[model samples]
Structures are given as structure tokens and as C-alpha cells.
Target: MDFLNKLKDITTFVFDVDGVLTDGSVFVSEETGEQTRAFNIKDGYALQLAVKLGYNVCAISGSRSKSAIHRLNSLGITEVFIGARDKTEKFKVYLEERHLKATNVLYMGDDIPDLGVIQMAGLPVCPADAAEEIKAVCEYVSPIPGGRGCARDVIEKVLKVQGKWMNAEAYSW
Candidate 1:
């Protein structure tokens, strides 16, 4: 149950967007016929930190958004699944394609839609603001709330546990 021990086992990170990345708010604007969502900058920095540490990162979500794709692309995350109603199934396929085992994957989610994949990952995480059921099932819970640096907290914990935190560029001279 030690944080570092969990990080030693993680090789990949899978994320759920609405609640995990954004603040779980869906803004629909009738005037411009556009849907808008807000993402947490701190959480995004954490994801980037994971990538910098060489962890493979991917996003899996039931909702599709051009904005989400653009943001992820900007972050240099290329593996993404949108409008996936059955996340577990997609996760299986993705793992096979990447030649990664389930035990090497870590997942972060905040809702029922993410339950299946969360249960399937080697390490499952939930933000402090996550649903009760998700919190109960997750292997770890971030101290920070979603859209408030929760992702960064998780990533930092994982890296620290794995002994990679001090090796990150930001920590170097």
C-alpha cells in the first residue's frame, strides 16, 4: 500500500476526461452551437510530467470533443479514444496493440463509465472529488480535487514511489 511500491508497477496511464481532467461540467452554448469544457492546468502539467518521465499516457472517454483532442495533441498525447461506450473492451484492444500487459497499466477515473477500466488496471486512482463508489474501489485517491491538480498529485506520487521523481528534468540542474 506504500505509494512508491505502486509506482514501481505502473508502465502506462489511462485517463477519463470529464471528471478526471475537467471539472465534470459540460457547457453547451446554444448561441454558437458549441460545447465547452474546462481543464485544470495543474493536472495537465502532471500529465506532461508523466510523459517526461517516459510513461505512456492515453485518454479514454465516452464523450467526443474536438477541443479535447486539440488539447491532448498539444500536450503530445497521441493515444486517445473518444466516444467509447465500452471502455474495458477498448482498453483490452489498446493493450494488445501496444503489447502491454494489464498489470503494467494505471488508470484514473471519477465515474461509473470508468469503472470497468479502473478495475482492470494494475493501479487504479481516483481524485478526491470522485464518486463514492469509485473512491471505494480505487487503489489510491489523490489528495487534490479534479481540475485542481489531482492528476499532478497522482503523477508525483507515482514518480516518487518509483524513484523517478528526482530524476525528472525540473528537479535537475
Candidate 2:
């Protein structure tokens, strides 16, 4: 099996929210000091499809934004973990509790804070605009930057290899 073959082995996809789901920008209101991040619709759709297909889709972020959580939860990700300082802990727990092997996981992240969790994934991935150190360590790096279609890039590759990309099941919903 080749590197691409490894993608077909993935049963779960875990993502970091800040830089992975967004462009790593924080929009804060000066009056109320409220922070918000933009999410990519393509990424959201692919994630929801993954969940609907019975793949474990999860989000782990250090951020505690109500809107972000609401959006991800709306997409059917029940394993969303916000305010996770040590994201690797959540990674391990998800695997253990699900009886999933490390090789069955694909984890995407984009910064120093996500480095440890990335290390724990069988298919460690990063966005094109990720930190240099993170890109250097990732097994696969998307050409698209975060908050764009990085999540879709990985999801497409996996689904295509697994004979599920753009299938009738994907269009049913």
C-alpha cells in the first residue's frame, strides 16, 4: 500500500478549528469584546457528509466561541471539543472509546498549538498556510489554505479512494 492507500484506511477525521477551519483570523468587537471566526461552507458540507456516512467527524479547538460550536454541532459533529489546550488528550480518548486504531485516524491542524495532536494521528495533515514547522512534520499538506477548502481537499481524497466521493449517498442529503 502507498501513501494514498493509507487515506482509504481512515475511518475518522479530526480537525483543529482556529487555523484549520478558518483563515486564522480573529474578529473581535471592541465594544463587547466578542470574537468570531469564519468557517468554509465547503468544509462544513464535506464534514457533515462524512458524519452521515458513519465516519467519525470531530473538532477540537482551544477557542470557546459559541457560534463556532453551534455551527459545528449543526453539521452533526457530536464529538466537538472546544477549549482543548492539550488536544492530544481528546484525540486519544476518541480513539480509545471508539475502539479505533491510530491508523484509522486523519487529523488536520495548522499551528504550534496543534502540533502535538497532529503527531498522534496516523495521517497527520496541515493546510498550505500552516506554520513552517507544522508543514514540515505533516504527512500530507493541502495546497489550499485554511478557511478555504483544506478540509474538503482531504475529505475528497479519502472518499474518492474509498469509492464514495460524489456517490448517490452523498447527494441524497
- Top model by TM-score, which number? 2
Question: How high is the lDDT of residue 83 in model 2?
Answer: 87
Compute the lDDT for candidate 2. 0.89
Look at candidate 2 and give me any clashing residue pairs.
none
Residue 7 error, candidate 2, Å: 0.8
43-71: candidate 1 lDDT, tens digit per residue: 77777777777789999989987678888
Question: lDDT tens digits, residues 59-129, model 2?
Answer: 99888877788889899888889988788887888788989988888999999988888887889999999
